[model samples]
Target: MDTELLKTFLEVSRTRHFGRAAEALYLTQSAVSFRIRQLENQLGVNLFTRHRNNIRLTTAGERLLPYAENLMSIWLTAKKEVSHTSQHNELTIGASSSLWECMLSEWLVALYQQHKDLQFEARISQRKSLVKQLHERQLDLLITTESPKMDEFSSQLLGHFDLALFSAAQKTTKSELKYLRLEWGPDFQQHETGLISNDGVPVLTTSSAQIAYKLLQQLNGCSFLPVEWAKKREGIYLVPDSTTLSRPLYAIWLQNSDKQSTIKELFKTPLIAQ
Candidate 1:
């Protein structure tokens, strides 16, 4: 089976527009359509339902998605293994933008102190991108707030951190405060729904804790941040009567990976604390 065909199919499924997918793949629209047709001919099924301005995967296409993703992941991993050089042992770690600022930055320092010879790469990306990199074996480890649900992956709890609302102004009421919403994950979102008023809208919504912190200081607004981060800044006080939120951090890695021993060793060190 041609990997390019599968890639094209996946791209089309993602974009839901042949023209956009073609542009992304650097292929002409006709070429993209031809590849999809070839794939359909090979599978003997209609993979997509086409309409005037919309396209969607059929039942057969939906069933094939996971298998195609796994196949591509395996292919990519094989390619990387065959092309690996022996100059130095390389490891790539990925995390969300906020995780990089809050914990990964310190963890990287500790890792290098312990293993000076190891070649390390850190990727700061969105959660979805990090998961994709993990699936493709492009990343050796992932630091995240939530554990991935894939059976092929394993996660260890690093530690929990407290998230509390901080503000530049003192003794402000919830109604008077201009809340800056931080994207911690699903659990935070659920917790926020209860705490935040239905009529209240955030002054700013951001995924980066660093950005939220800076913005709160500049705008004199309020935001929930890691207590560790809040302690570092001056004139930032916890909001009155606000509940402190705790979130678990996890170190995720693929099961039976080549870096399993290294991952286990790293976890054993006192890099992250409760």
Candidate 2:
């Protein structure tokens, strides 16, 4: 099957409009339509149903979407691997911004220093996007607090980190402090709801620790932050009588990943300290 046809099909599927797909692909609208027709003819199925201002995928298209994504990802990876002339081993790692902020950044630096022959590409995104990339085989490894419960994936507990309430105010009660909620994960949310009560909405809610930290400096707000990070920064004091939460970090990757040995060897030395 021609990869170009698959690519065009994917673009049309994404935009739900042949004209938009053509514009995005830098092709004429007729060319985009022809590619889709070619792909559908080869597959012996109608990939999409066309209506006035409404374009929706057929049953076959829905089934082919995941396969198409996986194939594209695999082809891209293969192209890079074949084109690279270097002897160094390359791995793509994905993680949420918070995970990168809390631990992966320091760990990655140490990794590069220790393993000079290894090269890494980091993709920092939201958890959902990271997981989707992992599923499509764009990421060799993913570092996240929540483990994916899927048969094709395997997860190992990397370590745990402590999150404690930190405030810029020298002295203040939990109720008096403007609460800045840093969304760690569902477990953290449940744990926090049980321990703290701010009466209503939080002053700020964010997934980025950096944003929360910046706001903490400017506002008299308290947010749960990594213990080590909170302790290092000046003017960020630990709130008295606030409950500390311990969250587990996990390294997730495909069960049948070709880099299984390499991934295992990389984790032999603990990435994050418990």
Candidate 3:
């Protein structure tokens, strides 16, 4: 099967329009249509249900979505490995911005001390993109707060980190404190509504913990931050009686990836133990 066909199918499914998918893939609309037709012919089933102004996946398309993603990911990984000519081991690690801000930098430094010959590539991406890269074997390991839903991926509990409310101001009054909302995860979202109450919505909201940390300092607003980050910086005082949220971090990787042994070795190091 041509990977191009699957690629085109995925783009179309994502955009829900052939023309849009063509534009994104730098192909002509007619070429995109032909690819879909070729795929449908090979599969002997219609993947999409066409409409006057909209398009949706059929039951078969829904089932094929995950398979197509996995297939492409494996193919890309194989191509990468075959093209490698370096003598040293190469590993690509991806993590959310929050995780990077929290401990990945330290871990990388510790990893290099033990394995000086290894080459490392670091990527800061959101959870969804990280999952896609892992599935495609583009990333060797992922350190994130959320676990992958796919069965082909395995996750290990790294550790639990505490998030404490920090304020630049001396007073701990909720009404007087300007709030900066930080995107920890779904669990934090549900837990926060009841934990802290503000007179109005946050003056600023950000998904990146680093951004929130800086903004909290500059804007003099309060936000929940990793205990490790909060402790490093001076002038940021913990809010009195504010609830501390515990978030679990996970190291995730593809189950049968070639880098599994390397990942295990890295995990065994003191870097992850911290």
Q: Which ten residues in a row have the lowest lDDT in candidate 3?
A: 79-88
lDDT of 1 by residue, 150-253 (tens): 99998998888998888887887556677898888766787886565455578898888888888886776788888887788877888886788888888999
Candidate 2's residue-wise lDDT over 4-69, tens digit each?
A: 998998999999999999999999999998999999999999999999669999999999999998
- Looking at model 2, the pairs that clash are none
Please identify which of the two predictions, 1 or 3, would achieve the higher TM-score against the true structure: 1
Candidate-wise lDDT, in order: 0.84, 0.84, 0.83
lDDT for 198 (candidate 2): 50
Reference-based lDDT, residue 251, model 2: 92
Candidate 3, which segments miss by more than 4 Å at Cα? Answer: 1-78, 84-88, 272-274
Give candidate 2's TM-score. 0.74
Residue 58's C-alpha lDDT in candidate 1? 99
